[model samples]
Target: MESNLINKDEEVIRRSKTEIVLKLLEYLKPYKLKSFIVILLMIIVMICGIINPLLLEIAIDNYVVNKNVEGLMIIGAALVIINLIAWILSKIRWTMITSVTNNILVNIRHQLYSHIQTLSFDFFDSRPVGKILARVVGDVNALKNLFSQSIQSFIPQLLNLVCVAVIMFILNFKLALACTILLPILGIAMFYIEIHSRRRWEVYRNKRSNLNGFTHEDFSGIKVVQGFAREKETEKNFKAMVKELGDAFIKAVKLNDFFWPLVELSWGAGTLVVFFVGYKLITNNEIKIGTLIAFLMYVGMFWRPIMNLSNFYNTLITNFSAADRIFDILDVKPVIKNSKNAKNIGKIHGTVEFKNVSFSYDDNTEVLKNVSFKVNKGERIALVGPTGAGKSTIISLLSRFYDPTSGEILIDGKNIKYVDLESLRSQMGIMLQDTFLFSTTIMENIRYGRLDASDEEVIAAAKAVNAHDFIMKLEKGYHTEVNERGSRLSLGQRQLVSFARALLANPRILILDEATSNIDTETEKLVQSGIEKLLYSRTSFVVAHRLSTIRDCDKIMVIDNGRIAELGNHDELIRKKGIYYDLYMTQYKFLNE
Candidate 1:
């Protein structure tokens, strides 16, 4: 059963590859002028190439055999001039092809970039940055080669073969037909080479993507790897990855080793057949010596282009392997799309309700079972729970990061699904557990919350979050560089800056997910005070490990195993002596210590 399923999947993948290739061909539509110019050059070059060897035949029969040196010299000069023209035309054709392919690739990359940005968080969550980068840069270049070199190289060769075949028939029909008879042998060999090489190249491309993803994941978690003393292990893993890549490449080359030999054998066989038959015809005096020599020359010329066309086909297949990987991402339709009727959340009342909501990350188990809650405007709700208690899941639902599998979540009496995602997210400010900062200045990072915000507004927002004093002390003050992920600054300092950014957003709903847990006490105090001021007249959800932060909250809910086990005021719940009470006592003691 598993083997059958695997075969079916392979068939599906092959079919999809064909579809993607057809779709990518459409990107060439806009550059009609360049395509036409390249094609025109190709025809001219092929015609000159076909006529080239005939010039030699003329020199041999009419000039050399007749003992006319002046006639030979004139014919030889004409050949030189035609060859020169062919070279120039070929150069221009290649130039146009390269120019067209590059512009098409640029358009593809731009559209891919814009589409990715429009995608929801789930799209990014499931894909790595390096994998996506490889698609845009690596895969794009692969397609570029397909358009620029493969198309340009193959077309001229194909046209040359057709023209040569026609001329050969006109000269001697029997030998021309006999020479092409070995196509079956070449076809069989090409089939095996193509199939075998494609398999190896598929592995090569996939391994490359995996290696890219590993690099991205490792670099992003370098601190963790170093702190855990896993550098040697990482090195070992990286070596294994590269070795696998090398093996795949070697496999491809080994298969390629036979490709040229097989093609040459076919060409040699055809040449021998043509030679023997033409010799017989000459001996019988059925064809002129000049015509026979010219026919042989044309056949030889035809062989080269035919061989090149096959090789170009091979290159196209391999490059398409890479292009297929890229187009796969481009072809993926985002699961979440905006509704035509969805209205922008210009202003929200902040009245939220989770009504009989249930959700599951997987089919086998439920994460949030029948969660029910409501919070009025200006209310601060604190969620407390042991790890894996669905506390974070609840927040995800509230923020519309994921919709509930069952039931509805409402913001100001409107179903969240019906609201514009961009507008909805903009109205909600989040201080995530892992705050991300770009390799930019402190002022810019803060101003990210409001792009049009001026320097004065940024300063005020930083001060409001008690981040101003520390930021001002830095070497560049507001212009201080916060390296990637704020690696240059201490954890507490980064959190302070993140807090200021959130404050600047001034969201109708604010969330702090252990927003103060990583900061020092001094900074914690500053953050706590900042929270107090920022939450004023705004709906807030605080997810804290330390119960001390929620004492003054309007309400507290203790989640257990994806269900709300208790809900009440902190003091009220403590008196009741239930789960919330027990959790508070244990966590509060740890905080106090």
Candidate 2:
């Protein structure tokens, strides 16, 4: 949607991320031993590289000028030795840098991912997946460049360039100054380009992330799109983003389009000036022709390093941009992390109460309007309502998915907010409308309900839910892989497995959300009995589309537009002939047939 794209705010275009860079450098302090070795190799590589131009001079002036054939052979042998030394040092440097960079990148990725898991649910609630992933993949890659690979390559070549500059100045100051004018001007030009291009590149990265987000969302909900037959519409929307992304990419390239060429052309002009200056100096017998030739060799030798620097100059900034993204995530203070004096969770007794609870997602019209209720241990409470009647919101409140805007939800006698989240959640089991199963074995998926549950316990849970028979029919039986998001199983089978998972949890509070909606009537009867066994000693909240699923509950509360309209047993509610009686008569009259 056009509404979802960035607002084109220049404020979001940040300066080069330097602080996080320093922080990343600080993170690398633990690896000081490896970094010290890397730096040592860099010095050796630079020193060896700087020797080549000097060798070219000796080959020309010391041997050829003397016209001594023996001298020529000696100089030529020494040049070969120099080249061999340089080659060996360069290989060692390359190997060290590559290995260190890969390892450092690996460490950073794991650390960042782990940090993300520690964040509370609200942080994920507000951000788009595309934007978040941009940080994880794009920004982390940038940090890899700035931290490890960039330092090694830039340092060695940079040291080599400086050494060559010193050599040129020593041989001929006038010629060297003429050659060196390009350096300052090129540096100034690069600075301007980097500043301007960073925003463009940041935008480019953001756009790319947006594309990733769209692709992720579209693919994740392909079934919904197919069901609605809106594939063409989705394609059209996707194409629009692709076109915008193309435009943004081209703009990024255009921002520094002249950078490389200008550097090269300026280098060319400087070299030509050097040639002319050297010729004039030679005419006056102020410098040897050999010296001038060697200086020319040095100038050409260092041009690549300088130009490559232009790219890294911009890259260093992009890496910072990545750090900025990562820090943005890290900076998010968790809404529900453990407090300073947070204590471990104790056992739950499952007495839940909502005292005048009212909630609004933000400062607007309220969703839950001072609704209140209570449930004792071992009670089966059915929450029945039309869509958006706040049944799920009430369950979400009970689960602490979102804190109430006003008033309190208490568990037993303790405030639910004060109760440790892990303990509160551990005591509750929730099966959602759309079941979630990971890409692992069926047994493992069920075992996730209670990680320490034995294989025998898992099998028992599956049998209770009537899923073990179907699972055993598979070729791999309990060990059969579910594939990503349970793509390997039918919807009904996934629901059955989810039921088994909840059964294995054996929680003190159970929330069954359409537990048997997709299953056939025969299986629903079996699962309903299994659910009864699971809920026998626990407080249970049942949200069901089929009235039959809730007929056996201890009490049924019919919610209408966020207010409880009626509360009674199935027979009593029918006899009262209220909203429940009308809905039950309309939606479930087939049972009487």
Candidate 3:
């Protein structure tokens, strides 16, 4: 039963490989003319190669034995010319094929990256950055040799092999048959080698991905690791990952190393058999000395192609595994896609409504229940909830990051699902607890919110967020380079910059998700007026860690267990003495005491 199950799985894998190859061929359609020219050149090159051996036989029989120097020189010169033409054709074929393959690679990589961008957040949430990078970079690179060189090499070798086999039989049937006695044995060895090597190659690729993931994760968390003084433990873990990767590579290489020796064994055995048989035929006067010599050359031609084929087969199996991985990512259709009838909504008035909304990451577990809420145009709404009470989920839903499981969210009476994603997102600005800044000048980071913003406008936005003073204090002012993720800046400084970015966007709807969590008391106080100014005339949802920040908001929603436990202004909620009042008292107990 187990064997049957494994056989079925292997059958499925074989079918998948066939489909992937077919899909990849679609990318080759544009290069058909060039590919056809390459095929023609290979055919001419193979003809040239075959004629060389026949010319040698003629020179020996008609020129050399008769001691005719003139005839020898003529045939020798012809041989050199034929080889030169073949070399030129082969070089041209390589150039043409390489050009086609490079374009195909670019197309494939572009398609993969574009598709990944369309995928929803859940896709990224489930996979690590390194794994995605491995598929995009390493796996795509592995297909380079397969596409550019494999067709030219494999087809020419196969033609040579077949042509030699036919010529040998026509020259001497018995000798040809004798030489091929070990062919079946060679084929069997190659088959089993591919089967085992494929499994090993898969293991090797998986280990490589794991190693990439580990390295990226460790480097990304280097600060935390050093702060906890876990450098020794980190080193030990890294060593273990490297050892596993090394072992997997060695195992795969060991399997591959067996292929060349196997080819050599078959070649040597075939040559010995042909030599013995051809010598007997020559002595018996059944075939001439020239024919015997030609037969020997034909044996080499046959075995050489087989040897080349064995190497090609090794490359094919390894790259096929890589191709399989790349196609796996391509096959994952984005779960979220706009419907055919979806309309591109124009500028929204920002009257947001969630009607009987419910959400779940997975089917079995619910994160938010039938929650409903409304935010009038330009009203400031604050959502106060404990960790995991679905506060962030609400913000994500509002932005249409993830669609509600069973309800509709409308902006100005228009279902957001119908809105063009770009048009919808363009009018909303978001600032999260973790502010991400690229490695660029401070001016560029602020201008990111509005790419077309003038330098003066960027400085104005920065000034509005109280970020311009610190930016100017730097040696280069707005031009000062902030390293990766703005590592050079203090946490409060990063948040201030992020706030400026959002403010500059001038979004009708703004979301501040614990945006001030990292700001010190003094910094928060300094930026409070700037924050109030930015929030003016914007429909805003502030997920506040410091409840005092939302005291003057139009409404304060105290969420508990994904439900609205209390909903009113801060003063109204405090008078009601419910969940809001309790949370407000507990979180502010120190200040009150």
Candidate 4:
């Protein structure tokens, strides 16, 4: 699946740079007034910069040459005032840009997370959790400088460049032409550098994402690693991944580093040409000493913005891949979203029917093949099957996690696909094999089943599931906080808490997919009593390996190879001595031994 996902990523149509820039600019629409203000301040700062060299020329030629101390002092004071104003404006612009950039990032992250939640289970099944997190956290963050710096540096530097060029031309056209003669060569160098650097940065981003995926998977299964004493092996693998990432970074940086030096070289060569030409002009009396000095200052100002622009361009290329990745997720229309005319199904009567349902995660293999089943208002069904035998796929289909590739699923006579997803899911409760709990007080964890449930209701549900005794025995009772995934709790305890949470929801339909596999026989019996009471009048589905637990269910389904091999009540199936009978007899004999 990881390899398939990587292939799909590689095949993604890369958006043009202009498209990305245009999309980024769309984020600024909401802050138009603030952006305008920022731009206005930048222009003011650039104007101040352009005036400084002229003031220097006045002080040098009109005051110093004439020995006019008072005039020189006035020009000196004006330069200070202009620079001080520019500094103040620059600081304000920085603050505004930072705030705007942060808000845009927040909006983007929120949208990405919300869209991910709406995607089909297949989307998650194909990708690692760490890779998704990388897009949400790392990729989104990479765009931070692109937003802030584009405004902070790009705009101001561009305006300063144009203004300085105009001032230099006004002072002396011949020298101005000499100062800019190397720009064409610089542009050509940058063009080649950008072409190479962009590809390297894209490679670097992919390597970083791979590292993130491995790190997340490694830590998630850290206990398993230690249990098998594979810590050293994992450490070796981790170092290899880190080295790969480091190598990719070095390759990218080697190319990116060329931008600055190339700009510097152009600046140095341009300054020398200006000096040579200005000397010739001075000797011919075509330009005054003050004018030549002012022209030199303008030349420095001119190249400074070019260097700044180059840095901004470098930032754009480096992070544009991240921007493309972010947009890729945003561009994916959720495969499991509500239809335009879909409406709420309101409260359902727990009648579920899968008519000739079939599904496949990909194009090649079908997980469920034309399997049909029906559960009346209050019938309890037990599904018994081997691993990967489509038992879980049946439940997932009923929940509408993924729509069938063929046929239709109806709940209370309405097609589930036409109903509002939230309304459809609200009436059903599911508990899976791998139980998970949030890092919070046990009381809060139970209350998550029904957010508005009272403390009394939460406690009652916990008591019903036989979890209250173990919970109360803790140091802080129900208020005790658990670690991530409730790692601090025993497996049986976690399953019990999950069971209680499901019970608290008061769902009309309940699913228990190996919900009691972790509990011992003694606890299972105790929990079974509560389960019997809770199962009264509520339609429930149980998938368990323990035949004893399903012996009394209304019906037992033996699913094999994506098809139902046997379906009957315990006594009825036992009389026929079929698949259910064989399974039950084997487990029954094992338990006796």
Candidate 5:
């Protein structure tokens, strides 16, 4: 996983540099009119900037030298008013530019989030939550400056550079030529710095993602760490990750620090060349003092923009790495999505068929192979299998969490792949062995199954699942907090709530994976009644650990090595004395022991 994060093919990296920039810039199209107005304001601001020094030159050369007090006062008053007007226009431009750019950022973030929701389960299986959050939260935030400052800062500085260069040449060509010699040299130096620094920034970003992944992984499993007395070991691992991230950052910063010094050196060199040449020209009377002073002022003005642009470029170089990561996520097409001509069946009758269906995780290791099955609209089937025998994979495929590599899964004689995903999934209920409850009140968590369910309906669902009695035992009843992953609830209690949630959905098809495994025998009887209610008139698949559900199921299939080794009810399977017979015997013996 770490290798995948840091290593990029040369071609991929080269292509992304261009693609990421163009993709980021595309967000501006929606607000182009406001952007254009900001550009016009920037030009006006640069015009005001250019005129100030020229006005200063005029007052010094014409008014002061001629000893005209009234002329000096007039030029001085004009300078103050021009600067005041420039400041006001700048304020207006900042407000407008921020509004436009902030809107663009918000839109991009939302689009990225919505895109993530459409991605396949396999996409998440290959990534850590922290790494995903880094892109959605951290990387997107990094782009805020790129938009907000691009119009207000980069464009104005660029215009200033152009205006300064043109004015310098117009004022005196020879002095301008001498002063401008350092421009290309500095540009080349900064270009080299940008290339090297970008590579370091990419490394830093990858390290930060790795650190986030580790931090999230550790905290999520902190209970295991403490239980096993591995706190010191975990602490050491966390320190190593943090140090690696810090080192990567320091290396990038060390390279980035070269920019300011290079800018300062180039500015000093340009100013010295202009001063020496202008002094010689003045001694020769080839130019006036006012022109020489203006040339010096233009040289200084020119370097200020160069410095600002270099900073902006530095910002772009740093942020482009983050942008590339973000685009990488957006570029991932979901492995499971609706076909172009997909149908919305609206509602299904719950009949499910797996026609020679086969599946693999990575198209390499097969989990299920040409397995065929049929379930009637209201039949309940129990699957019994050893660990890694592809029992859970069956339900996952039925839920359309993944697509089969070969054959088809159909509902009501319609291919699931040809059905609209939202409509198809809305009619199914899934409950897992490890039921996950959100950090909210039980009422809200139960309501998650059907968002518009009334409070009374929610309570009724809880009662149907036999969760209401235990829930009422809490101080706040249904309003009691579950906390993260329902840490405050017992394993059986949490499963009961999940059963309630699934019941509230009132799906036509239901999947319960080891739902009765963790409960005590007494609790199991209560849950069994709820399960019976949930399965009434609905097609249901049960992967069970206990004997009662298996004995009562309409059919029991013993799966082995991705194939159906035995299929029958308990009495028939025992009479046949096959794999299911052995499994049933072992389970019953264990329960008796």
Candidate 6:
């Protein structure tokens, strides 16, 4: 798993930075008008800055030296007004660009989340939930600065750099040429530093993702950790992961720290060149002291932009990995999606057929092989199987959570592959072995099955599943709040609520995959009665290991190694004394013992 993750990181790094930038720009297209206004404001601010030094040079040479006090006062007033105007424009520019970048972030995050929802189970099955959450939450947020800085800082500073250099040359070409001699060398050094720096940031991001995954898993399973007295062990593992993340962050920061000093060194060197060259020109009486002073100011102005641009580049290299990770998720095409020609399979009659269907979660192993089955409408079928015997796989295929590797699944004589997924799933109610409840009231959790269900209807569903009695005993009855996964409720109570939820859906096809496995014997008897009522007039498939619970099922199939080993009514199967008979006898004997 670690090696595969390493390969994925390397692949992400190999993606062109230009590709990431171009993809990011697409999000900005919607706010182009606002962005244009921002750039225009920036241009105005740049012009004001360029004129300031020139105005100072004029005031010193033309007014200050000649004892023209009134002229110097006018120049000083003009400088103050121009600066005020520039400051106001900068404020407006910052506000407008901030709105644009924020909007872009919202759009990108929304797109990523919507796409992830459409992805198939296989995508999620192969990754930890914490790792996926890191991409959706942490990685998307890292891009916030990238977009804001690109418009508000990167473009403005780049333009400032060019404009400053141009004015410097126009004022004194000799000094300008001498000051900029080290630029090419600085550029080359930044280029090499950026290449190494970007890789470090990518590593840092990967380590952060790993830490998030570990933390999420550790906390979610805290019950097991404490129950087994493994808190110290888990803590040790968590500290190691935190240390790994911290080390990666420090390495990236070290490279970034080198960036500012390098720019400052070049700026200082350029200053020395300007003074040395300007002194020679002064000695020849080619340039006045006022002109040399202005030249010194321009040198400061030039390197300021270089420093800002370098910071922008630093922001880009550090957060570009985040952009790349976001796009990686966006680029993933959902393997299971509605086909172009697919149409709604409106209101299926619950006749299900799996014709020579085979499936595999991956390339190396087949979970199900040449499995064929058919069921008529309103029939109750029970599947009895050993662990990993492909019983659940069959149910997953029928629900179209996954498509068969080969062959076809049909409902009401229509191929499910050509059915609109939403339409098909709407008519089926599925309850899994694990029950999940949101952090909401019990009434709300049951209502989740049918969003439009009224309070009375929700209560009725609860009554039908034997959940109403227990619920009424709570302080708030149905309105009592529960934590995530119904952690506040007992395992049996949670299962009862899950049962009520499925009952409320009123699906044409009902699937119970070990739905009563967690309930106590007394509660299971209550739920079993509800189950019989819920199964009436619906095509239902119940998967259970407890043979007694499924004895009254119309037909029982004993599955072994991905094939139906025996299929018959309980009496017929008992008479045959086959796999089903053995399983039933074993459980029956264990109960008596």
Q: Give each model's whole-structure lDDT.
A: 0.82, 0.79, 0.86, 0.88, 0.86, 0.89
The digit string of per-residue lDDT tens for model 5 on 1-593 reads 22233222211143355676678779989888998899898888788889988998898888899999999999989888888988999899889987997798788789889999999887787677777877788888888888876776777788789889998888889998998898788889888998899888888888888777778877898899999999999888788878988999999999999999999998998899889999999999999998888778888889888888888788888888888877777887888899999889788898889999888987578999899988888988999889889999999999899998899998999999999998999999999988899999999999999999999999999999899999999999999998899999999999899999999999999998988788887788888889889999999999976666768888887888987788878789889988887877898888789
Residue-by-residue lDDT tens digits, candidate 3, 1-593:
01111001111133255676677778889888888889889889988988888999999989989999999999999999999999999899888988998998999899999988998887787667777787799988888877775667677788878988999899899999988999899889888988889888887777777777777777888999999999999888788878987998899999889889988988898889888988888889998888888888888888888888888778877777778777777777776767677777788788999999999988887888999989999999999988999899999998888999999999989888877788888999999999999999999999999999999999999999899888999999999999999999999999999999999899999999999999999999889988998899999999986888899999888888888888899999999988888888998996778
Q: Tens digits of per-residue lDDT for model 2 on 1-593?
A: 11244223112324345665566776666667877777777777666667767776877778787787887787678778877876787687667767777787788778778888777666677556665676788777877667654657566667767877888788778988988877777788777877777777767666777777778778888989999999999898789878878998799878677787878988898899899888999999998878888888877866767877766665675555566666666665666665566555578878888999998776876778888888888899998878888888899888888888999998886787776778778878998988999999999999999999999999999998789899999989999999989999988899989988998988888998876678887777667777777788889999987887888898998888877888888999999999988988888667777
lDDT tens digits by residue: candidate 6, 1-593:
22224113324534687888888888888988998889889989998999999999999999988999999999999999999999999999889977888788888889999999999887787677887888899998999888988887778888898999998899999999998999999999999999899889889888888888888888999999999999999888888888988999999999889889999999999899889999999999999999999989989999998998888889999998888778877887788999999999988788988899989988989988898888999988999989999999999999899999999999999999998999989899999889899999999999999999999999999999899999999999999999878999999999999889988999999999998889999898788778877898999999999888888888887888988888888999999988888888999899999
Cα-based lDDT at residue 348, candidate 2: 80
TM-score of 1: 0.91
Which clashing pairs does model 3 show? none
Please identify model 4 stretches exceeding 4 Å from their true place. Answer: 1-13
Off by more than 4 A, model 2 = 1-15, 23-27, 55-78, 119-135, 142-148, 224-233, 317-326, 558-560, 563-593
Worst 10 contiguous positions by lDDT, candidate 6: 1-10
| lDDT, candidate 1, 341-364, per-residue tens | 998866997999999999987689
lDDT of 4 by residue, 1-593 (tens): 23324212332346899999999999889988998899999999889988988999989989999999999989989999999999999999989999999999999999899999888777787787888898999999999999888877877788788888888888889999999999999999999988988888787777777778878888999989999999999888788878978998999999899999999999999999999999999999998999999988898899999998999999999998899888888887778989899999988788888899988988999988899888898999999988899999898988888889999999888999999999989989999989999999999999999999999999999999888999999999999998889998988889889888988998998998888898887778778877886788889999999888888899888899888888989899999998888888998899889
Residue 537 local lDDT, model 5:
93
